[model samples]
Target chain A: MPVWQRIYEEINDPGFVILCAAQDTGGEAAAGPIFDAANATFIQVVDPDHIISSAFNFVNVPSAAWVDEQGKIVRIDEGTYSKLHELGEGDTKISFGTDVYSVALKDWVAKGSDSAYVQSAKTVTGNIRQHSSDQLKADAAFRLGNLFRTHGYADKAEHYWDLARSLNPDSVNFIRQNLTLSEEGSAGETFRDLMGDYVKSGKDYYRPLDIQSPLQPKDEDR
Target chain B: MAKAMMAYPELRHPFAEKPIHAEGSTTVLYQGRSITLARTGAGAGLLIQPDDLPGINGFTLKPEGACYEDLCVPIGANLLVDQQGEQWFDLTGFADLLGQPYVADSEQRVWSFAEIPAKRDGMMLDAMAPDFKVTDREAQVVSMADLKGKKALIVTWSSW
Candidate 1:
């Protein structure tokens, strides 16, 4: 969160905005404090329904879409991260995210349409995932679960949530969010095993990023 | 991992058990908004009053059809039903016609509909950002249309 705030500040452009959404089924209680701790001035959203994800057809958290001045999507559905991050320690140490994304983001903010990172309309359209009927139904079921969860119908909530996962096994968001409410936690053995099977089944967990590595440093600094 | 990084099993089902809405009313969930319709025609599927159409999904039933912006879907027989003497709109039927997916808990009188695929054709075909309405932390309504003329990076994250 702070990293995004820092980048938002660095960009310092009145025209550039960040709408950072937390896709937490736990709602405000789960996501509010994190945003508060970051002191995020940019638009902050706590989406219990994962409405943003559904609109963009994103199957996971930390996904993003870059909309240009005319409301055209220039880039989208990447495993967006503000910076490369490492967590845990010793044998369990895990690393994810990327340093190049933020750099490319800065370049886009500065150069607009001319930025090398700005993909063409065709590319952007092609990149958007084509969700099938069952996948779409999965979203409906997930939202139904959230509605049930909100109103304290735990049994119905669990039913619809399980239905969602079964309907769209590709939805990492549903899988992780469901796991988060379980005793085993989000990254426990169950999640690990599911991810392993996911990969072995030949699914692209995160669509491979199109950005080049070893990004060239821009002349200007904020 | 920090204790903060663990899943919050405690937070799940935190709300007190209660009836979702008035016993007779129907609740519809769409685009993050939950609207309860106090009056619905007695029918096999969701038969909402024609007047309630716009509030639920922003499509007004016009002479041509249910229209939003420049796009209009022809009102077919499947979308309208007559129960007793009252004319009602079959919202679930309309959803099926639009290839819109939905989950209905008939026992609870609640229906949750996914994004209507037709509403997203602009984005899928032209790279235009699909419109979505969500309230920010400050309780301000934000939508994709509101972000026009600005370069916006809309990103999703999670504590988990």
Candidate 2:
């Protein structure tokens, strides 16, 4: 069963509405299942040119902003829905006790902005993220890496990607794509061997490869 | 006036050190140490650095009053006046006369007068934080300023 089908079945309630705002970059194909499964009205705003992203300063995907019926914003949070039953539980455990989405959603439905839990303007002003010089440099490197990748120079792409990762180690896409690319080469024989060593040592680089076998036994035999 | 013929019993050197006492009207003291105390009209000490002759240098308090040592002038409600005929308070003169600067404690409260070296300028307290705006799926602006008069909380994150 597709992910969208599952989501459609889950949010069948009449009053519930799921709004998915996606940047039309790389992840839309992965998000297609969920968007299709939504039973409520779905709004897809695609920034194929990334103009909206630049205007909104969106650095990552699935970021959402909640607004009231009057079009006034009430909350903004990252959105992620997975098919795994334990996904929500795992997210709760990892988010350091700050499950803002569930709590804020309930509050918005119950009391609107009049909720005592809502934050004041001053607090919001003090908490916003400002772009630093380091982040700007990382962005430049990441863009250069993308250009290299698109222009048929994988090695140059990898170089810029490495620079980007070093500059901003916290970037999830940078880490994920780099590792995934490393694993995909030559049926991931090298990646699987590395994974075997890591497993033997009780260390984990990332989620284990769940697809077909990563090892090329013929190459080893040769 | 209770007068006592204080003797230089210890053979105090002219330029070494001198003890200061408050007298009723007339003040008679040794001059070799190059210390002057002025009674400013506002009753604040105005200590002047010896290097800079004339300017509102710094402030200090002494047994006599506030004094500007650069001009070697005594300032008070009636003694001295500014060019505009306004009463002057010269604390720089008082320090130049006192030959020492007032020291302040960790809490920025004044402690005692001591010959202290000048300090380098302190680090700036201002810091630049990451500033960004959040918007909804519709590209609507959601700024912190919009939340004024209402309570709100911001959760920073990304959904890669």
Candidate 3:
């Protein structure tokens, strides 16, 4: 979040805006402090219903869409990262993210349609995930669960949430959001196992980034 | 064990147990909006008042059909039902006609509906942004239409 705030400041283009949404079912209590710590000046949304994710058909967090001035989606559904980040220390340290996506974003903001990073409408539409009937029902079920959760119907909430997971087993957002309620937490053994199965089954947790970094060239390009 | 990133087991059921709505009222969830209707027709399916159509899903009762934007769904026998002396719009039936999925808890009189398929046609064909309305931290409503002339990056992240 702080990283996004930094990037938003660096871009500093009045015409460019970043709407960062927290897809946390825990609502503002869980996500508000993080945004405040980042000093986010751009649009900040604390979405407990995961409305943004459902709007874009994103199965996981850290996903994004780049909408141009015409309200057309120029780039979408990518695992967006402003820069490389590391956590912990010593052998237990974990590292993730990339610095390249931020540079490409800046290019798009400055160059608009002329930016090589901007994809064609055809490609953008092609990249969008086509959800099935059951998957659509899953969204409804998830919202039903959220409604129950909000109203203190814990039993009903659990039931519908379980139903949602069964209807759309591929939704990592649902999986992790459900796990957040458990004692082991979201990144626990269950999440790791599900991610393992996801990889073993040849499913992409995120769509591969199409932009190429100028610093690292492919063998063919080199 | 991996360190827990954004766990909140304590916040799971923090709110006190209470009924979802008043005894006679019905709650409808659509596109992230929760609308509680004070009056409805009695039936196993959701039969909302014709006048409450626009607030629920932005469709209005017209002479031609239930109209929204440029698209109109011709009124069908199952869509508009006549119960006794009242005319109630069958919302669940309309959802079925539109292939819009929904989950209903009849006991609680709550129904949650997914995005209407017709509304997403532009996004599927032309890569247009879907119509979504959400509120910012300051409680100002924001919609895709609000970002018309500016380049916007709408990103989703979670604590977990």
Candidate 4:
């Protein structure tokens, strides 16, 4: 069984109320399968406008915020892990290690705040990377690209799209979306080639985007 | 009114027949009629329009007082007119500002604002998560506050 599948089963147990809050910054089509397979109730919040993510100070996906009974945030850990999976045995290594995550979660549930592992509010805030002005500009450029795409200006959109990619090279959505757009038209070769070069650099930032391409060998075996 | 005229010397609009003194961080004139005037630091002041409430910290002038959704705040005796003839509010005089019934005091846990340009960071994770409701899948009325007592793990995932 897959790690997520095992996690799903554990969640479905009657004692546990596995409420998943998805930061659907763009839309909700991708996480649908896991939610369904887990047979668990998933609450999908839309950030199609990114209003929530910006307000909550979320910068990464698979980032989990643990809220206590009083509604105050208790823990925030990045990445997901389950007892059923290995670290490098998948197309994506987005999962956090199972041993570390399970021990922490079990301690949290058993002892609540008394748990020594419970992180302080300062530590939680410290874990969040402070966003820079340059990144905000890149985000704006990407938004403009989306707006252009919506308004039927695909060619002009690529300019802002390329600017966004250059500013924030790790954005898989921008990379893959622009690459797909490039394949649709003749103008995107330079941009596509740029993304190809980033892939060659062995940066984990582009891993998710590379999953769609057949050129790269699957990282699971390696 | 003595209070209004004392606080606001420039509030000499012809249409402000019954200037109501409302106090806050600064004194403000609520004209009975519509007119525009430039205040020193707080921008311009005009007749309280119906639609302008949401933009002004989600406050609307009501018959009882400044109301927000289900709560209402009373103007009380602190509302006064000054000798020079202007209206002002003694914000400090309003003891129960937060507890004002006219003001919607519902505690909201979720923050819903856009990112400002001052903080620049590249997109770290971009994905859309699914939103489901307690009773039905199509119900969109799910609020983050509803899950207050439970530990919620919000995983943002996007298929696109």
In Å, residue A22's CA in model 3 sits off its true spot by: 0.4
- Report iRMS values in order: 1.3, 31.9, 1.1, 20.0
TM agreement with the true structure for every prediction:
0.95, 0.36, 0.95, 0.48
Write the residue-wise lDDT of candidate 3 on A1-222 in tens digits: 999999999999999999999988888988999999999999999987888988889988899999999999989998898888999999999988888889889988999987778887888888898898888889999999988888889989999999998998888999998898788899889999999998899988798877666643122211
Interface RMSD of 2: 31.9
Write model 2 residue lDDT over A1-222, tens digit each, in one string. Answer: 133334434444433333344432233332344444553233333222222222222344334343444333433323322222232455564332222334444444557656543433333222223334344345445544443344344555566667766765434334433443331331244444644654687633222211112321111111
Q: Is candidate 2 or candidate 3 better by lDDT?
A: 3
Point out where model 2 deviates above 4 Å.
A1-25, A37-41, A45-64, A67-100, A180-222, B1-160
State the lDDT of candidate 3 residue by residue for B1-160, as single tens digits: 6546667898788777788789999999999989999989987889999999999999998899989999998977778889898999999889888999999998899999989989999998999999899999999999999999999999999888
Give TM-score, chain B, model 1: 0.94
Candidate 4, residues B1-160, lDDT tens digits: the string is 2231112112111122221222222222111011122231221222222343344344555679866556566665533223235444322233234321111101211111113221111112211121222222354555555665665554443332
The DockQ for candidate 3, computed on C-alphas, is 0.78
Chain A TM-score vs. truth, each candidate: 0.94, 0.50, 0.94, 0.56
Q: What would the per-residue lDDT of candidate 2 be over residues B24-143, giving only the tens digit for each residue?
A: 111111110113333223333332232222322332334464433322333344323353455453433443344433321112111122221111001001111112233444456544
Classified by CAPRI criteria, candidate 2 counts as incorrect
Which has the higher lDDT value, candidate number 1 or candidate number 2? 1
Q: Least accurate stretch of 10 residues (summed lDDT) in model 4 chain B?
A: B102-111
Tens digits of per-residue lDDT, candidate 1, A129-203, equal 999999988988999998888889999999999999998999999999888877778888899999999999999
- DockQ for every model comes to 0.78, 0.01, 0.78, 0.10
Superior by TM-score: candidate 3 or candidate 4: 3
